[model samples]
Target: MTLVGRTAAIGTLDEVLAECFAGVSRTVLIEGPAGCGKSVLVDTVVERAAAAGATVLCAVASPAEQDVPLGVIRQLVHGDPSLALPEDALAAPGVPSRVQDTQSFCAALREAGRAAPVVLCVDDVRFADDASLA
Candidate 1:
């Protein structure tokens, strides 16, 4: 897919995907105004990653779910039996144990990564649940 004005951004993400496939862990955050195509950019990458046989986990956050603890994390792995991960019980927001919750989430993703190259894409992240953001 050739995006009109996103060649550079797409190239960067493709390089990230390449690195990911090469066994390098990567984190990408795409932030912009409501109509700036952040989702489009990420969706494009997700498609590419999936096409390349990479494991693609995605979540789109919204205000309605912002108060749901670990909501975004749930979106990533919920109902995805391929991950074969046990459900996590994240402590509620403002709990000091959130640090550990983050590690737990990472552990789950790390387990999945062991199976294949993992590409996690979260969009509209401004409204992600607090604990999920940890």
Candidate 2:
């Protein structure tokens, strides 16, 4: 779908994407009432980033997944190619609440960032699992 009157928002996101590609850290939060096109805006930016060779990780959360541990993270990892995360990383359905597990996930993200610019997009984030949020 073509977005209307989002030139400024897209420009801002493009700048952030460039900064991230150049090894700088940036974050932007997009919020609005339901059906306001926040997700479409994000999807546009991330699709552009992916086309430019950035690693784009996205997850659209739902209330049904709120109780699942690391549900968002799991979705992100599973969507990545094999090399994005370690072969054994987050492979289990029921992830244990261990420090090592959390550390491993972090390590994997850091590793992926080192490989390429990483863009993480979480839509409907209010429904994201508490563990994933933490």
TM-score of candidate 2 to 2 decimals? 0.86
TM-score of each predicted structure versus truth = 0.83, 0.86
- Compared with the true structure, what per-residue lDDT tens digits does model 1 show for residues 10-127? 8898898889888998888888877987878888988999998898888999999888877788788767765432334533433333566567668777888887898888888899
CA lDDT, every prediction? 0.78, 0.79
Worst window of 10 by summed lDDT in candidate 2: 81-90
Compare the candidates by lDDT and give the number of the best one: 2
Model 2 scores a C-alpha lDDT of: 0.79
True-structure Cα RMSD, model 1: 2.9
- Estimate, for each residue in 26-105, the C-alpha lDDT of model 2 and write its tens digit: 88899999889998998898889999899888898989888777778778777555423344445654654455656777
Point out where model 2 deviates above 4 Å: 79-96
